[model samples]
Target: MKRRIAVLLAGCMVMTALAGCGSTGGEQKETETGSIENKEVTEKSQDTGESSGAEDTISGEITMWTGTWNDGLMDTLLEGFYEKYPDVKVKFEYLPWDGMEDKYLSALQAGAGPDVLDMAIAWTIPYASMGKLQKLDEYIEKNQIDVSDYYEGAVETLYKDGSYYALPYRSETMCLFYNKDLFEAAGLDPESPPATWEELREDAVKLTSEDVYGFGLCGSNAGNTTAQFYSMMFSKGVSLLNEDMTASAFNTQDGVDAFTFWSNLYLKDNVVPKSVLENDNTTNRNLFAEGKLAMFVSGSYDIDPIMEANPDMNMGFALCPGFEGKTSAAQLGGWNLGMSDTCKNPDAAFALMSYLASPEVSVDFSSTFSSCKSAVDNEKYADEKLKVFIEAINYGVPLPGSPYMNQITDILYNEAQAVLSGSKDAETALADAEASVNKALQN
Candidate 1:
């Protein structure tokens, strides 16, 4: 289970690093940037188009590369692909997560990369900037594929400037998971979890004991820490950067408050585990399952693992708590499939991608793999546990599409760690981070 958690974190942390590096067939272009928003798109109002494949025979062989899902799952998914286009052959390979960027960039630079690539959506901007990914706007328009049919955040996560390079394959959002037994033992209502930051702090104090901490916070990985921090800041209306993405905007009062909130949880209260300094989501999940922690913030991905680890442990879920009047926010993270600009068989590649993103397949795939609101609405597939995440997705916000994404993550992680360790105050830490990040953005 620890190994699995490590693998998941490894894949995500690279989203920032991999998004910053990578070369393509053409020179890199400057991308337009936008601020992250907590607003949700009106459901079912966005037009989703039909699949683009024509009835006539369109046959060509294509290769695909994905990091973790096994061949069996791919085989099952591609069963429909093969059935739809009997003449198209797919050579699918399970690419090891380690050094995937080097392998991919090397292969792509050598003019020998897979026809279709599945990667974290965070990589979409850099990959497209390098001209390694095929633009899907024309294909989408030609196919009449309604981009709105998917979660707005998942769909918009791939868009940079005015183009989309990939289609959403899977998505996950963060939520509050509490130990019901701990709540009851603390004399709090087991059925009602924290609904605001003050409530969360109060509950944590009551839940804390010599053996069990109240919260499990993550500060180890730059990407994970940045994500967790962003959710907190967003809930208070803090923006990572100003609109147009030219400079840092998180050094304000909200930023200080957000960092202070977490730092206080660890330092002032001692309710969060000290291991948070080096803990990843997996470590936190394991601790929660072991009954060492009462509550934590995480994504839909941990559901199966927690259930597998402690099937009988009573648990509850709720939206990530925010201030009384502020909106709750969660980070939208996921994978997307994009076509290589140099692919010889783009039609075939898109045919496969289109099938994977189709309505039926999207809902079916969500049953065991991903979370999308349209799919989760089906009672036959999802239950209350999954629905909590689905509702959280409605309040989801994406990380900004900046070329210096990796630098931003590092700045936030380092400064927040400093504050949590008592080496600096939240104001000074964020001020230094703002200066460092502004310098990076200038370059």
Candidate 2:
């Protein structure tokens, strides 16, 4: 069933054009200053006697690249954009998440990238530094777009050096997803999910069985595992980077303690499985859905798959558990849309971007997929589940926006895997990871 849904989504995505900009049929204009011009042109009149004005005369095609998740959501969003601008055609190319980084880098280097691109928040800094992304401060100001409506963390993720490069379309934050069947089997309350880390530890120990683990972690999924680990650090009042983003502060005692907590779950308590060291986000998610695990940290995207896996599975989701000195913290994950530097129709592209950011269009887009805060706040989309997601965003933190965050995260995963596999202790693994990350930051 999961394979069928993936195939259907893939089929819908294949209908659109995903290639980059083709060669212009006329004399191509290249500007070193990166300034765009607005021009009006008209050929001999046809049947209609009316003349089109400059503002009504958008005539170029814009290509957009995105990762495939929900085809219904993309179609709905493009349908409205196409209706509003008949002259400007949009071509969408869907790329698999696994190879997206390499594909984006190659496209940019070849100067054949799409006009509009959807990328993870973590990639913004690296891409922006390479001049692959167009600065959007002027565009936002010219459009008079209100930034206050977006979740604070979502807005902060796209900024570098005090400039905005992209705008978020959807946001996801981690929550505790529990199986009611498991709770009943373990003589626990199904309705009340754990609200704090202490309660969660107790619940996990009680829920463990020979065939089923109490909890699961995504140690093999580097991006998500690092993100999940960071959320734990935040709950313990530790930050990945200093406020200036120049040095690594993750080696602090609080950071080490957070790592120890997850490691101890498998090492000392014997609640979660040692096999989790080899599992990624998808693997863990599948394990939970199959009723092999009691609880897991997951996002809104897991809803469809979990429901399909067990049609009668009674599952409950709550905000990430809090610690003694801190509130619950979930790391925000999402995609943003940005115009390419080589785009020919900047005006039309800006118009489309601005329209999409409006509350009405945002709500329409969110209805198909999980949307950002502005869309969730819309009365049309307001519901119990969405309200929970929105509240989760209020306590969410953005992933590290440093240009070298990818490298930093790689070190984190390597050490985390060692800790989980019992190849190294938490203190030694975290200390080594922190030093490696700090060295990478210097370069």
lDDT of 2: 0.68
Which run of 10 residues does model 2 get worst, by summed lDDT? 1-10
Expressed as tens digits, the lDDT of each residue in 45-108 for candidate 2 is 2234444454356657776776544333565565555444545666667665556667776787
For 1-443, candidate 1 gives per-residue lDDT tens digits of 00000111111222432111111212333322122111121111123332325633667678787654333456556655654565577776665545666566666656677888877666665566666788888888877887777777776667766777888856666889999999999999999998988789899999999999998888787766777778888898887878666788998888898888878888898899877788877788889998889999887667777889999879999998887788888766666788987899888888888888776675544323343455665655456787787777767776765556666788788998898778999889999999998897775
Query: How high a TM-score does candidate 1 get?
Result: 0.84
What are the TM-scores, per candidate, against the unseen true structure? 0.84, 0.82
Q: Residue 209 in model 2: shift from native, Å? A: 3.0
Best by TM-score: 1
